[model samples]
Target: MTQDATAVAAAKVAGVVRELTARVMQYDATRDRRAVFAYTYFRLTSDLAANLRTNTLSFREPEWVADLSVTLAAAYSTAMDAIDSWLGLGAARPDGAPGGEVRAADMPESIPKPWRDVYAASTVRHSYVLEEVLFSMMAHMSYDLPLALRALDPAAHGDLRRHIADFHRMNDLLASSVDGVQDEISARYCRRLHSLDRLFTRDDELFTSYGIRVARGMAWFNCHRLLDPDAAAEAQGSISRSTAAFIAEFRSPDDWKRRHAFRVLRALVPSRRQWPPAGTPPA
Candidate 1:
């Protein structure tokens, strides 16, 4: 399917993700706010640009693309809130102010478990940069996008096939972009020393960590499932339970091998302050 020329024409904007990334990076440079999340956003935007370039740009319908693009940008905005807070530049919790907060704050309740769980995990813990990026993607794509779609049009969608295509196509693009994203992340945050390939991708199914491919597929399934009037409640409950269970593991110290490894890696690297009060904040 050729991309909807009309969507781009009407909005007077293209490459929304690309543009947002650029602006975020420029902010980072200007303020020298090299917060860890900044690099995560960089990977996200770069991967999104790759997705648009190679897979869905020409095929996705403009409306869907616009929705997904805006959804992503909104998620990025919320993330920036956290980043800015960490830099002492601003205060915005992932589940706080910002329109996306409505969708996020209601997670695992009004929305799916993945979104709620991922956000909770990230916020509650001091995680690896990879966890920050991946969990944010998990929550935004898996929850917010679908929830936003339902809100935009509550009518039962007849375009399941198209939705699935777009969803899977984006996933594929992310899978392909993983290596490159990992490279950029490692270079900047991981001391430009250790490679995170094995820790992240692991060469399992679809070239990602074990079960993530299936998890992503499930996220796609849940999107359609959430739109079903009858099934929506049950789906939300199931997602909530599963997400809660996964999050519970983090609460226990025994289940911290992954977190421990990341800590060791980060500690091995020399201390590098990302941001240290650079004059007055930008106006």
Candidate 2:
């Protein structure tokens, strides 16, 4: 695609992301746990969109990147839409009434299993916000990302190395967004997150960034496996099983112990002054 074409595609994708962000913010207001991930996703996509518009990163294949963004965002949007429809919250309902009884078996096959797990967990009152967000991240990054890459077929565009380089460049963007995203989550969902952050200090950001780096690195490896004709079938199953297992681990009882430890540690530490002061809140 030409530069002009890429610009148009990027703009369209940005519009889609903007709409999804609005929907997710509304969900957040309703105390929907899924918003944990959705809000974080919006933050990351907003940063990506800004970079795309300003050509800040000078990505080797901006067009391919833009297309992948659309694919990945569309997958999330589609999964959320399916869940909404199943739950009778779809916009298509004229009276704002339930869409009527629907069984899980009736859900569209296009909505992947990882996303199903995400929506299911969102209904649990005891689910931690951090775990919800991580589950959503795993679904998007670990499960959907490699498939999105395969769908785009990077080799058809040009040199595969250029595509890989652009992919790694995204790691820097993810790392930079961690602190801001954590702040948003703290303010909107869990205020105690501030105390937790003070306990860990900069190590909090470092750990989150490291996790993003590792997950994305695995995604790229999976992308290569998906592209391999002989490995494709096994790769598909592995992606689903591995993502589900990762999410299961997050739901384990041991996580409760870890969370309890953080709470105890936070209580033992002195509280630090929060940013923007008491009178001036985040806009």
**Clashes per candidate, residues 3 or more apart or on different chains:** 0, 0
**Number of the top candidate by lDDT?**
2
Candidate 1 residue spans exceeding 4 A from truth:
1-15, 22-42, 46-63, 75-126, 149-154, 192-213, 237-244, 250-283
lDDT by residue (108-168, candidate 1, tens digit) is: 2432446445555554323344554555454554555555555544366745555666656
Q: What residue pairs are clashing in model 2?
A: none
lDDT for each candidate structure:
0.49, 0.66
**Which stretches of model 2 miss by more than 4 angstroms?**
1-6, 89-110, 154-159, 194-207, 253-283
| Reference-based TM-score of each model | 0.59, 0.75
Superposition TM-score, candidate 2 onto the true structure: 0.75
